[model samples]
Target chain A: MPQGQPEVVPDDGLTTRQRRNRPLLAVHTGSMKGKSTAAFGMALRAWNQGWSIGVFQFVKSAKWRVGEEAAFRALGESGAGGPVEWHKMGEGWSWSRKRGTEEDHAANAREGWAEIARRLAAERHDFYVLDEFTYPLHWGWLDVSEVVRTLRERPGRQHVVITGRYAPEELLDAADLVAELTKVKHPMDAGQKGQRGIEW
Target chain B: MPQGQPEVVPDDGLTTRQRRNRPLLAVHTGSMKGKSTAAFGMALRAWNQGWSIGVFQFVKSAKWRVGEEAAFRALGESGAGGPVEWHKMGEGWSWSRKRGTEEDHAANAREGWAEIARRLAAERHDFYVLDEFTYPLHWGWLDVSEVVRTLRERPGRQHVVITGRYAPEELLDAADLVAELTKVKHPMDAGQKGQRGIEW
Candidate 1:
């Protein structure tokens, strides 16, 4: 809660402790960087608290493994903290099928949404990261209204974080927390290129 | 690069390969959450890459140790990756002095900035997190122009990430990458209390 936090009363009729324990729907969207990075940061926080983590990447290739994915996957497999289940479009969402066109990508996005909707209904994980999920709604591959409804009605104390640029209005309306990252400047503007450790 | 990456040519005439190796001055600011969290997330990335990390917090009291500090400190002390030196205003910046009233806090912030300026001049760490550094500048406790000049002319390829709301224009102008986080919705607005794992 930084600035202009709306005055909210106890509308849910829950005790403070109970309300603190409730699940959260968080959206990270905008033109600047770190939307997915912030979502993954929350996942790291949640995982450290022994919460089961589920990560679903919508756009990145299966071969494109970011460092967070590697660290979380390794930490999850360490048999010390909560286990993590990671899925990507080419891998779990599309059943390892090759996709080269917009149509196939749209279909996979839909498939991914369907699976996530089912998991939300089932309350499979304590924390769910829908990394770069806004693109499908922005692209009209998934119905924004339906996505909002499903997330708003998601079951149990499962926290879900969706990240991408151009997040739909309906989704924002339904989210419990929303961060719109605006760009004030960028390294590329200065002709400085991105490196693997810092950029990825 | 996400949406609307500025079309920038290499005005410095450096090769893309050469530009890729240069470190950056990143700023996360505005009236929203995830500013510091995003900076900490980058620290995680840097830790994984074996880059020595230094985190300096200005506004938050030293008693308030966030989860990232714990994790990074643990990783740093484990004799793995690179070292982490975390300093808050109350700890390293206050010169072991008792703090009371806003004047003392302001003085501590100024002292903290002086130490960090020296560190930046010395190129002590590969990656630096100036958490909540903008508040002092916004409050006129620190000179924004001096901060910008020092950061712009800091020695070595050490990447610096500064986080806070209402970052001064001069700092943003000097930054290599800037993210302005905008508030859309917040749990505090819904009267949902913050818990340790999620909020910290």
Candidate 2:
């Protein structure tokens, strides 16, 4: 559990309820697994609460069959809870002329950030999960300062969760909740590969 | 983002299929939230894969309403997939007469370990989630070496995930996957309380 609290409270003197309702900006980083998985779990909770959810994935190929994506999509289509929009920014690699080039990835990243920024301004989703988003910021493909400013100024009750290793300092400083997943140990150190269902 | 691979592969030369069929022992620990939450998220995935699930909460109160518990229980009871067994070790606080002191928690912890051991021996569930289990080992209430040995020698394809802040060295060494969640930032320091849906 996080033992440290923000040292100072806002001058507004918000009540517990108000603080609870306020959207949180969270960052899940560090070199370990479950960063995206944990954020997805929060999305599940948000969906259960009838909050609209949006998941934007980067780095990971769109073809990656993450079980959570299928499960959450089914739940959304079932009409049993809030709607969910899952966008995979790494869907296609066939850029032809610019195939496998850094510029291609950079352009796509910038485009993805632009979309997220627009949605944040519009408050399109109650909960926004920017899965592996820190990579773009770290690679300098997307402007970290711009992202910090946009996320800080996002409207409504939009809770944003960004996950990726080597998160920049600017994002961490602006985030209300940040959890860094450290690798205490892994089977791969013993020669095991990532397994299905578990790794996915 | 772990760069290290297991130093050597076993002489057994197991194929991908054989390896994929094997169970995993994962530990989620450290002074940050989402240890159990990530484990539960894995449970959600396991449920989707038609794997039976067992969740044992060692420290949290039974009366506590965790969103994952309710969600998983509902999924279990729905009969759409595998069943789930939810056990709360700290259900009642009134055992002070014969127990309830530090010793009481230790006794319960031992008993809980025994039950889990029995079930693991019996292969009761494909996925077992030992939530907040590290505290007992850290507290000397449960023997770390014993737990490590038990996990190492457990039979069948039953996967286990243990979560707590101060995980024991023995358990970490035995675990195939271990994640340590570090607290980078928190709202509590600002006097903000944990919120519904997000926290629970």
Candidate 3:
């Protein structure tokens, strides 16, 4: 795409603006990092446009203080852009010092997906980020077919972006935009561990 | 990487914390829309860490009110995180209602690179984003070897990220992390034009 111009224009009957303004179902997936980071970046753009934003973290614990979460929460309260709501499934529950059983985590993930489904049905948010959501679908904790169907039929101008590794093929087929963040190189390859602010 | 852990730990004669805290040179390239957006997301994390940020937009016009720029400017002013300074070369100059010759734009890019070099020498910023910088190297407007050398030898712990398509081989070779944002699918394929708040 040259300066955001499409390479091949389809013979759609819609006007340029109409087609351009359509809501997007974007998926950021790959083994490399930056999947959720890129999704949060899009959320920033949506918030800048005064679009209500909702973030659901599936893998991270609610106690985990991600820098993006803090920044966005401050931005939401500042009344400069749009409102933001952050929720965590705490399935992986890192740093919480308490681990749930696999079955318990599966149940928790299902509950989280149910909440997202309800919100989608109600058209609650202009932008929805299912952060690390692919885990549930990949692990068969959530039904891939039902998730795809619901997202495909989601109403209003809601833009939903899902980020995680191993995104289901069904979800990718339903998405309008899919970004695969491939790693050519990483400092981790040089024996570096994750650091605060940079990695979190 | 499982929970930010390196797949293999090397015996590099450094402690975990020292190895983890090293600054990074990241390059976001490939034909996709979210390169700059993802880089901005990293900037948010850096800001939350109280790191001074400097963004140099090599392609966008100076007058264009990019949503990220506005949100970041507000964040900088609010004193909620670190300070942010944004600069534009106005090379593309879209929406500026004025067209500069190719040579003029090339000169402006060189000037912008010079400014970044000066800042790096002075350690003026903790984080630096060279937005759409690959265009200059790809078009032969700037010396790729020199840019790579300058970045590689830059003093202090300042982290640098360059974003754009067609990143030069030398730059990728020098970078510690290179994320290729491959476009799996796009709405533009359906003849969608770029829309405000999303594209800009």
Per residue, candidate 1 scores C-alpha lDDT tens digits across A27-136 of: 99888778888887777667767788999998656644366666676667655556888888855453344444444778788888888898889988999999888988
Model 3 collision count:
0
Give one digit per residue, the lDDT tens place, for model 1 in B53-158: 9988885555443556655655676554668888887554544455443447777887888888888888889999998888899999898888888888888889
Q: Rank the candidates by TM-score, best first.
A: 3, 1, 2
TM-score of each: 0.85, 0.83, 0.89
Q: Look at candidate 3 and tell me the lDDT of residue B131.
A: 90
Model 3 DockQ, alpha carbons vs. true complex:
0.55
Model 2 misplaced stretches (Cα beyond 4 Å): A1-12, A63-65, A77-81, A92-104, B1-21, B63-65, B77-81, B90-108
Evaluated at residue A86, the lDDT of candidate 1 is: 88
Whole-structure CA lDDT of model 3: 0.82
Classify candidate 2 by CAPRI docking class.
Answer: acceptable
Q: Write the per-residue lDDT of candidate 2 for residues B1-200, one digit (tens) a residue.
A: 22224466766689755765678899998877788878877776777777888888887466443556656665676666578888767663232243334446777887788888888889889999898888889989887888888899999788999988888778887888888888877877766776766876
Candidate 3, residues B1-200, lDDT tens digits: the string is 22567878888788887787788999999888788889988888898988899988887565443778877887787788899888777743332333455448877787788878888999999999999999999999999999899999999799999999999899999999999888888777766777665666
- Which predicted model would earn the best TM-score? 3
lDDT of 3 by residue, A1-200 (tens): 22567777778787766787788888999888888888887777788888899988887455443778888987898788999988777643332334455447787788788878998999999999998999999999999999999999989888899999999999999998889988889888887887776786
